[model samples]
Target: MDESNSRSHTEEIPEFVGPYKIEGPLGVGGMGRVYSARHKVLNIPVAIKVFFRDVNEKPASAKRFIQEARLAASIEHINLVRVMECGNDQDDHPYYVMEKMSSSILLEMKKNGNYSEREAIDIGESVARGMSVAHHHSIIHRDLKPDNIMVSVDGLYKVGDLGLAKLQDIENTSPGLTMTKTGLGTPHFMSPEQALDAAHADARADIFSLGASLYFMVTGKKPFEDEGVQAIINENYEKGGPDPGGLNSDLSAGFCQLVKKCMAYKPEERYQTMENVHQELIDLRHRFHDSVKPIHFDTCFDLAGTKKEEIERLMEQHAKAASDKPKKEPVNKLYIVIIVALLILLLFLLKYIAL
Candidate 1:
């Protein structure tokens, strides 16, 4: 069972978690509860992710939680949320501080339906760019989803929540938690390899996830969605991916093809590196440079009219002018030719008269 969602903040809300004071609850997940906090002296706002009591009760889970913090802290990328620090409270629960984002991409998605082609591609590009850095360091974000991606007020998209991330090197594994053949990660976005065996799941698994996430961004729907987690996992293992273009007809062939390549069932068939996905998105953006638009509208248009007659009169005049604008007289080539000929004859006559 996914404990992150089941478990609530068991411990009483403390005024402070380490040096940071808790402002409020951000959200709860399968692993732990996240809180909006601020540094005592610095007064800097940060997000503090703390493991639940049940997770902390187990040594393996505690170590894994801390490991997630360290792994995230190690990776430095603008597209990724920065881990500021990690610490333990008096209760022995593990928690880590991350740079707080103004809002999450998931929240934005809920507010606004599907993202535009350019917006979706841009978000995908940023995520792939961050994942490329993680892959370079042998880290794979097993649970890459819209909910895990954060968007800042300044329009910067970043990858966050590395609880399910796996480090490539086995020797660097956390003390208690061992990377077993057990499958881990969200069922809907999981790759075949990840579903079959998480231990062996590699960078390709993340590629599949990124593709799935991209599909969701453009279509406002999950590729493989079912009532049960097992059902979704089974579908991902047996069936082909849902056509992104089918849901969003505006999507181009290149966009659909890129998505299909990413969501390929076989890991070998999918993109081998995050860099490849990133490059493809870059090219896609270039292909539609002229049509690329701002991710969000900058200005709002007020439609209220102060004077009813003034508005109606102006609209009527505009419509009348627009209707008449294209009514052009057809030019007569014969008349033009005759006029030129007559002018030439008159010039000759004038010359004859002068002579």
Candidate 2:
């Protein structure tokens, strides 16, 4: 058995939850406990998230859990975790089954230390692709952290755990479902606007969280750190974190700029859509790893606060430098002919003298 899916001796493992047999507890979250389970009839491995009895007693929590299932199940993207089924258990608690993942990004990070710049870019791109689809459907993933990104056995990175997602078209029918309270999401990764009012968060909010998560992946440290939760939340709200490149000097300037743009203080300053974020990551990959050419002017221009005059000046200098570069002169045909003639004459002279 994989160490990640090891049975938890602390919690009692249920023999069955609906039609699935619980093999062991995968992990516990704020609203539910996930378990490694198998379908009773098909015998296929799956993950079942069963809500706590207290959560089921609360209408808001129950509604949110069901929404998570419905929203995730409706989307079909390779980069998003697939929801198999959702129903209630014998104990009257809500439960949802999803495809079992090999491990989460958080677990992988802990096991393999911090990811390199290239690895972080790959993970960020996959997440952006998945989130872009969700955004198109008018879903805002209010919570996006390494813990919510799962890695499959085949090494595909998938975005999971959408319990806190905000659907634009959906109404908050439950009395307490409105996220008017402050500090609604994970403090370290939440955007400033989201920390203030999660109900109004949009695609840009998810971009901010993705930037924070990428910062952690490269630097091995959370964007905001504090002794108290409220202090961290305050830091995220009042003051933005340091540049990711400053933490990890090995990261490329373009990548650092991309991350900084994503974590911009205001939503308007950040990338407007997940598709834009994905495209930036793609450009970063080419600029940092694949291409031997200089960074694109438009890429630098896209970064917030980058001056147009400076970019144009730099591009002009690059062009001038290329034009001024000295080229290798071709071998002189006359010189080669003279040398060959001299060699032939010397050979003839030596042969005649010997005779």
Candidate 3:
């Protein structure tokens, strides 16, 4: 079950975290509870994630969690969730303010039944751009799933829970972590490396997870067979993959090929980089957009306004450039005219003498 809707923090007493007023609980998790908070004075809404458990009690876990939060905060991109602030109050339990996503795509799709292939491709393109933007910022989402892909009301797509799985990466970071050296992840979504040995993981590991999500969108089914968490993870050790082509004829050959590359047993065999996968998705979007005629707004009026502004800016830039230059040589126009008249008379005198 999804956490966003099921969890609400409305009834909690002293409805505030830091400066933001906690209007309600957004959701709950094993580690913490998320709240819908509004800034006291600014009244800006933010998602406040309050750690319900004592992370300090689990030192490495705490560090990993903090690292994830810090790393996420450092990255500034449209698709990625933005971190606002982090601090603790009198209780000493910590919470951080972050960008609130409108809703999860997984929840929405499940609610609406499977989407048409065209819609799926469009969403895929948006998600790819978001991921590409993150990769450009040197931050891998680490955890890319349908639940993490959130869509805003006006068609803005955001990737949430950036590096949320980083908490599991902290071997030195958490002594009292989750009682395991290997990290934990939901079944069917875990990359083989993450499922077997986390140290073998890297950015492309996210590509694998993305492929799994893409497979789900197209087939309306998870990539791997549903099984116990341990059982599915054990299969990761064995390195098994689902047969994408067998299930859906609607799945394009290129799409399945990319998915196959993504779910490759060897990480090297997967997409070389996140950008590579993003490019493929982008190319696919272009083709799809081309096939389905797009609405291109004629900017005659808008373009005219834009051009006017641009010319004004250029004129300002020209003036600034002119002002920045040192004073030029003042060539007297009258003096030049006088010199020309003298030179003309001299030429006439020379011509008369030659005649």
2 versus 3: better TM-score goes to: 2
Q: TM-score for all predictions?
A: 0.78, 0.77, 0.70
Candidate 3 C-alpha lDDT tens digits along 1-355: 5442233333244477778887876666545677888999998988887765534477655555566678678767777677888887557767778877778878887788766556666666677777766666655565688888887656677787754444324445554543343645555777776766554466777788888887787777887674865676565447555546668776666667777787776788888777788788777667656664222244224444456567556555655766777998899899999999999999999999999
Give residue 329's lDDT in candidate 3 (0 to 100): 85
Candidate 1 lDDT over residue span 143-193, tens digit each: 898898899758899999888887887445453365566668887788877
Query: What's the lDDT for residue 260 in model 2?
Result: 84
Model 3 TM-score is: 0.70
In candidate 2, what are the lDDT values of residues 124-147, reduced to their tens digit? Answer: 999999999999998888889999
Native-structure RMSD, model 2: 11.3
Instruction: Give me the candidate number with maximum lDDT.
Output: 2
Ranking by lDDT: 2, 1, 3
Which of the predicted structures, 2 or 3, would earn the higher lDDT when compared with the native? 2
Question: What value does the lDDT take at residue 51 in candidate 3?
Answer: 61
lDDT of 2 at 108: 92
Question: Which of the predicted structures, 1 or 3, would earn the higher TM-score when compared with the native?
Answer: 1
User: Which of the numbered candidates is closest to the native, going by highest TM-score?
Assistant: 1
Where in model 1 is the C-alpha error above 4 Å?
A: 1-6, 171-176, 227-230, 237-239, 290-355
